[model samples]
Target: MNRRLLGAVAAVVALVLGVGALFLLLPERGQGPAAAPASTTSAPATPTSTTTAPRVLVDGPVGVPTRIEIAELGVDAPVMAVGTTPENAQEVPSSLDATGWWRDGAEPGAPGNAVIVGHTASVDDAVFDPLVDAEVGDEVFVTGSGGTVAFTVERTETVPVADFGDVAADVYRSEGDSGLVLMTCGDWNGNSFESTVIVHAVPTGA
Candidate 1:
């Protein structure tokens, strides 16, 4: 496959993953507070129901993310909006402490993969310096006008410029449930770009 085209496609796929989940209003993905100890002194005990509380998901207007916080990685950064670059590649955040979410895809709580891209290196601290260190099950919190949505890291991989097709299929998938994909350029491999680091996460309930 053409290297440049593949690279560009991967970038756009990442972009799609970022925006794909923007509209889905998934229930908060965390365990709620423990139920209070059953009343021990009550003369008559009230019957306890087994049903779980209904999950309340508020679908707000197509929200533009304002912030993203990954507590495990100590990454709390502002999110910016971007589109394609002049070279036709996806545009990236200009600052190291910020990430750009492609507005072309679904809004944050939506039912598709929302892609968030950032730089891995710069004169200052890389916005995603610890992204590679992220483990499955880690939490990613995105806050927007709609509300804060929580995502749990599900998978991470590095895709070479030449083998972008497989990952492209995965990231650009529109048939599945809501998800998020975080992307960044990794070490250079001499030909084009070295590889792309991607993290796939899904809304979590804890």
Candidate 2:
């Protein structure tokens, strides 16, 4: 994936210099959490349409995402602001219990994609272990210092890591109706994985 976004690159540099937390602009092979093989199962592909039912909008201050919850998946984890690493790739949280929110991008409930990433397998509990089982129409919620935003799953896709260029538009889309994306590495077995699991959802209500 290209680290062409100027804002993301700048944030990553700042994060590394000040906080000392490493952030990568792209997925560095052999540097992330342990990879696990994805179970074989027939799953639906990405939705062709972005159409969605009109959702109630919140007319107030929007806060930075602080946490994310997926009730069906038993996920209720902290959200930390993350930028790119010195290598110019997306940043991953140091702890598996936390999910990294792309700080340089849109916030939840805003007119763009708000991204959150996590690990599929961790030393403790797998944070996104159940992400592959996520189904369209499932519920997801994000809370920040500003407020809470609700969303409903619209699609799930597993894309080969090398083919990320094909879906770069959707992943880096910064203009559109409010949306949320959850991502984690998958199909990996200790060394390498073929793809990543991306859960796409849209804001439904406050």
Candidate 3:
């Protein structure tokens, strides 16, 4: 999308950076753990309504996602709502075993894109360590208050850090059928990653 559109959605879908231990900029490998890396990607685009019909907000538990499962990759982890940090970047889950959902973005199974993020590596095995191995057609299941929503992976891209902003805008934009996005660090270079792995999926019916 355009720069103006990305700016408009900045408040709702802030970019997620400096997440996980991999993002750290510590000394070369074998020295010690790394420090958090500098921000790389830009904020997301505004999510448009899925339908042209009048919008209606449903009260009560509106299916807040609780867990995410990718059987093909042997990933099953708890999901938690995460908001932006004081600096406006999205916050990741403190626990390495959990994944963070962009709370201000679209809800899973809804019309917009539901963005979920996990660390590739941390103190121990991170929740999305195997995400880079995910392939097209893999099944991703997200369980929430509403129920479970099934998505079929459509594609995967390893985007250079400098180009992440454009890719993120398309992945997180809310102008299409219900969809899902999974993100993590990529291309380890001893000290830090040079790229970001982004997986795009669509609802089973879509």
Candidate 4:
């Protein structure tokens, strides 16, 4: 073929290839065609209530106490972790000290009954807040390093500060089980006492 003719054919082929490449890379902007979506794109997954595990959980060491969280009222706070010692007892929240129930008992989610004590007075209004709203069968979720432990509210009552044993029925109810008990001044609403709110829960279903 002649040189001019060969060059013209080569130019036509180059132009076609260039146009095809542009279409593959760039989408038309103004009054052009809509860009096709990527076929490999995926949508986000939604959360579901159906879970394999139980709804309530307890967290922390087997014997070392930590924080307590109640989902019903968004009550997540750093609980004063105390065993049965003068120093450790002093560390207990003043509002929670009236009750002798200390860490000498069980740690959260442990084998035995884990007892936590708090106060109901408002000198600082620092504990047992909104205690009047608690109800039976309410689930209390405790959390720590171990995991979350679940408990049901067995009962709540008011008693005199002198009446401590009344709660023993609720606190030391059963044996050989994991449980949690929360006590606040409910005996007599005086200098350091008020309605004692006690929460009892155990491994009922699982």
| Candidate 2 residue spans exceeding 4 A from truth | 1-61, 122-124
Q: What is the C-alpha lDDT of each candidate?
A: 0.58, 0.61, 0.63, 0.42
- Find the number of clashing residue pairs for candidate 2: 9
What is the TM-score (0 to 1) of candidate 3? 0.72
Once fitted onto the true fold, the runs of candidate 1 whose alpha carbons sit more than 4 angstroms away are 1-8, 11-62, 188-193
In terms of lDDT, model 1 sits at 0.58
Sort order, lDDT high to low: 3, 2, 1, 4
Q: Estimate each model's TM-score.
A: 0.67, 0.71, 0.72, 0.56
Higher-lDDT candidate of 1 and 2:
2
Q: Which residue pairs does candidate 2 place in steric collision? A: 23-84, 23-85, 24-85, 24-89, 24-90, 25-88, 25-89, 25-90, 26-89
Error of 3 at 140 (Å): 0.5
Evaluate residue 161 in candidate 2 and report its C-alpha lDDT on the 0 to 100 scale.
60
TM-score of 4: 0.56
> Compared to the true structure, candidate 1 yields what TM-score?
0.67
Clashes of each: 25, 9, 5, 18
Residues 35-142 of candidate 4 have per-residue lDDT tens digits of 222221112112111122323353433334345556675455555544322211111343222222344456666666777654444444444554556777777665
lDDT of 2 by residue, 139-180 (tens): 987776656778899999987665655565687678877788
**Lowest summed-lDDT stretch of 10 residues in model 4?**
8-17
Model 3 RMSD to the real structure? Answer: 10.5
